[model samples]
Target: MKKVIIIGAGLAGSYLATQLPQNYDITIITKASAQDSNSMLAQGGIAASLDPGDNPASHEADTLAAGQHRNKVAAVDQLVHEGPKLIQTLIKQGMPFDHQANGALDFGLEGAHSHHRILHAKGDRTGLALTTFVQSQIEHVHWQENTTAVELLVKNGTCYGVRVRHDPTGTFKTLTADAVVLATGGLGNLFPLTTNDATITGDGIAIAARAGAKMADMAFMQFHPTLLSLHGKCFGLISEAVRGAGAILVDENNTPIMAAVPKKDLAPRDVVARHLTWWRAAGHQTFLDISAIPDFPKRFPGITANLDRHHVPFRTTNRIPIQPGAHFMMGGVQADLAAQTSIKRLFAIGEVACNGVHGANRLASNSLLDCLVSAEEATKVIAALEPAVTPALPQDPTTIVPPKLPSLADLRQAAWHNLGVERTKAQLHDFHTWLAQFNYRDLVPTQLSPKDFTIANLCLCAELIDTAALKEPKSIGAHYIKEVAHESTAS
Candidate 1:
């Protein structure tokens, strides 16, 4: 049996593991425990064409609209067309989906969607439910918890395996395999205010880039309009589904802030979040009023429990404090439709792979769909590739540079201020200069501790974002410039 090594045991890895041919053996590795993935913390449901009168073409059009038509038309077609059938497969396998009182499947609507086509489980706990549901079916695959990949084992222009360290015992070992799959989540933890799993530090992307894998759209990140603002590294999220359910964004005086936008509360996330960003500058605090949803507590048990614990009121007309926070990444290591990266025998899926499905901005709930679709497509390709018996191991690489105790918190704070919901060239340039003092490009591909390697990668990821952001003079989707597109055109 050919052995495949999969890094990051989140939805993409777990789901892809189940999709491979029976003759193949699998090894799924995680940075920490299985629960430390962003997939396990997702709030909104997976979007699909599952409702009556809904179809893949409509879903495709809506997805294109949300992404501002910057999405790859081919990739979006695959996700929209194949996603429903995969959802049905899961449903038939006894996966529980929310149902209406009439026993019909209760499809939910979210930002920028033309129809209510999101399939959720247990309300806002779709991430938790989906990851858990997929993980439950694992049988023969070897699982490695508390293990972190320090580097991709690339030699002769092809990746053969990974060099990882078991955090529990600090044991470093090489896991050779026929193919390597990277499903590491996103870079939310790199920001001060985020709804991403803290364990996500862009390790997968960094390692792939160092191995010469092509990366794209490194600057396009989506900020959720309503993460519960808090003074913690990781904040809670108030799902956008609240607005889709008729909730409204309000000021302290209860005036609707989104009144000027098209579709009002249902405007695309980029527009709504940009509005809220400026609204905050004008002195009125923002909140989401879900009074229209009478059975809010019963429908969203996870959200209600969180709000109650934080002393937030959930009654009619009362508001829950909301602010934009680092939510999702729309770009990553570039991958083809089959999930194959530029590097031979190396694949990237999930949030870590910028496969062009998201384009400039990601549509709500499409991430889970992207995960399943990318994995299924990649599995078909991986099944046909023959595994190499063994390849020449890498020569010993060494770097003697001393570790710099970089302040991660300070970097995150700076990124949020300059590269958050809005940006300008001046801020990005200033940030770039400050960040350049810690550049360690020459020291990579050598022996470095996990903390050192992560700091290096975060700096690299930050530079990529700043450089790309500075180059784009026109505002588009989630990436907003202080100057409008017409102003740039006039200049």
Candidate 2:
């Protein structure tokens, strides 16, 4: 049997493992626990056109409109057209999506969507429900928990295997295979305040890039508009679905945050995030009011429980504090429709791969759909592939020892300051210069701790964005740079 090594058992990796049985033998490796991922923290749901009135054409149009027509036409076409079928497949696999009294699927609307097409389950526990359910349906697959992928075993433009460190053993090992699939999640951990899990440290992207894979759209990082600002810990995301379900963004004076915009609370996340960031700079606080949504506690038990855990009291009359924070990444190792990366025998799926499905920004709830659809389609592509002769794995030579660097907290804080919602050319230039000094050489090594590698990936990814921002002065979509701002007085 042909062997395949898959990295990061998140949403896409989990589904792909379940699908690829007869074609090959597969082993799933995750740095964190097998089921732990950004998908678990996903509060909203997947977007799909299951209603008769909502067809793929309409879904495609909504997705295209949200991405400002910057998305790859064919990729978006496939995602909207063929992605919905996975919803039914998942349902057959025991996905517990919400249903109405009439036994119809309960759909909800989000920003930049015309129809109520998002399929959610367990209120705000959509990602958890889908990932958990799909994982439960797996029959036989090799699973490794707490094993971190340190490097891609790419030699002469082909990926042959991976070098991993078993967390418990604290020893490095190499797993050679005919093919390797990278399904690592996003790079949200780069920011001090993000809605992503700690494992999302851009490790997969860095490994691919160092092996000469082509990257695309590094400048387009999307910040969620409603993250509850917290001290000492990660920012808790207030899901956009909250607004879609009748919650309103209001200021201290009870004025709607998006009063000037046509969609009001339903405006695209980039616009809303920029507004909240600038609003705070102007001495104003942002809040989400659930006064319009009836039975808030019963309807959104998860969010209510989260608020309660944080010791924040909420009532229909009380507005929840909110601010913009780093959320989704729209770019990575550029891949094709079949999840094939630039490197031969290597493929990337989920947030780590930039298939151009999301252009400058991604629409809300489209992430989970992208994850499942890419995995399902990639399954067919891999199943038909003839296994290549596995070469003897390369030796891991003793590389240069990296110097003790500054705290990762310093890197994340800088990224949040200069690479957050809005940016300026001058600030980016300075940031890029500072990051260039390290130049990814500070943390590149064969045998290092996972946290150090994670910090390296974050710095490298940030530098990529900073470099792109300098070259492409024109800011479009989430990569917005104000034309001009005051020099010393600007906050």
Candidate 3:
């Protein structure tokens, strides 16, 4: 049996494992337990044109529009054409989705959709439900929990395996395989306030870049406009479905923030996030006025539960205080439709890999769809690959001593201020200068602890985004740069 190693146990990795041929020996390595992922925290439903009024063409159009037409036409076409069938297959395979009283699949509406085709499972717990369903179906898989993949074991430009650290015990081990799959999620934790799970620290993308893999669209990080904010910190996300259901974003004076913006509450994520950021910068507190949405507790039970846990008086006031938080990364290790990166035998799926399907900004709930479609395509290609052959790995002649790096807290805070929402050239340049102090762009440290490895990975990925942002000074999509702001301020 050919040995296949999969990094990450989230929806992408877990679902990919089940789809791979039974002949392959599969092992899944994750930084935390399977449940601790952005996948499990996802409340947004999956997007598919399941209704009679909806079609793949329309779905593709909406995706392109949301991505600001920056999406790869071919990849978007494939996702739209193939996603519905895959979703239906999952439904037939006992994937429990919410159904109406008429027993029809209950699809919800979200931002940037031309049709009501966002399929949710168990109300607002779609991510948790989907993760549970896929994980329960995985069999004949080896799981390495509490472990971190520190480096890719590549020889002669071909990936054979990975060097991982067991986080708890601090022991290192090399797991060799015929092909390596990177399903690790995005670098949301790079920002101080994010909707991402703490485990998502850009490890996979960092390791890939260090292994000489090509990266793309590294500057387009999406900020969700409605994370529940208390004091100055964000706690949980208020799904876009809430706005689709009838809630409106309002300032402290009860004036609708999006009233003047095109598409208003239904605008693409980038627009809404930018507007929210500007509104806040102008000294206004933003919130989601939920009074228009009837039966909020029933419609958003999960969000309601979290609000209650956080001691918010949403039940009485019908308003949810909100702010934009770094929610998704539209840029990552560049991969193709088959989830193959530029490097051979290295496949990337889910948020970790960018195929231009999401373009510069992701449509609501298309994330789960991308995870499904790409994983299925990757399985077909991986099954046809030959067995692994252990090759002699090269060792570096010089080892640089570790430099004093910023604390993870400090690093996250810096990234949030410098790289968040609207970035200026001055901010990017200064952030790049500070990050240059501990550059690991060329070296993947094997001598560091797991925590240091994470910090190193974050630093490397931050530089990648900083460089990419500096290269493109023009504002486009989620990579909005206030060049004039910097120029005027500098002068």
Query: Candidate 3: where is the Cα deviation over 4 Å?
Result: 396-400, 442-444, 484-491
Please give, for residues 1-491, the per-residue lDDT of candidate 2 as tens digits: 87888898888898888888744788999998976898877887899999878988888887777676779989999998778887888788678999988999999888888999988889988888888888887657788889988888887888988888888888888888777899998899899888888788988888887778998888989999888765535457888888998998888888887888767788788888887777879988778988888787777778888888887666735667888888988988899999998998898889899999998879889988999888877877677768777676667666766655446989999998899888988889888877766636544546566667777778878887787767765767788888853121100
Cα misplacement distance, residue 39 of candidate 2 (Å): 1.1
Measured on C-alpha atoms, candidate 3 has an lDDT of: 0.88
**Residue-wise lDDT of candidate 1 within 392-449, one digit each (tens)?**
7876556466655368878788889888888877888999888877745655434567
lDDT of 1 at 247: 89
Off by over 4 Å in 2: 231-234, 484-491
Give the lowest summed-lDDT range of ten residues in model 2: 482-491
Candidate 3 global TM-score: 0.96
Candidates sorted by lDDT, best first: 3, 1, 2
Worst 10 residues of 1 by lDDT: 482-491
Candidates in order, TM-scores: namely: 0.96, 0.96, 0.96
**Global lDDT of each model?**
0.85, 0.82, 0.88
lDDT of candidate 3 at residue 475, scale 0 to 100: 77
Q: Give the TM-score comparing model 2 with the true structure, all chains together.
A: 0.96
> Residue 43 error for model 1, in Å?
1.9
Per-residue lDDT of 1-491 in model 3, one digit per residue for the tens?
A: 88889999889999999998776789999998988999999997999999888899999999988887889999999999999998888888999999999998888998888899999987899999998999999999999999888889888889988988888888888888888999999999898778889899999999999999999999889999999999989898999999999999999899999888777898888888888999999999999999997788898899999999999998788899999999999999999999999888999999999999998789999999999888999998898887767788766436666656778998988998899998889999999999988745645467776677788889988899999989875777788887642211100
Error of 3 at 124 (Å): 0.7
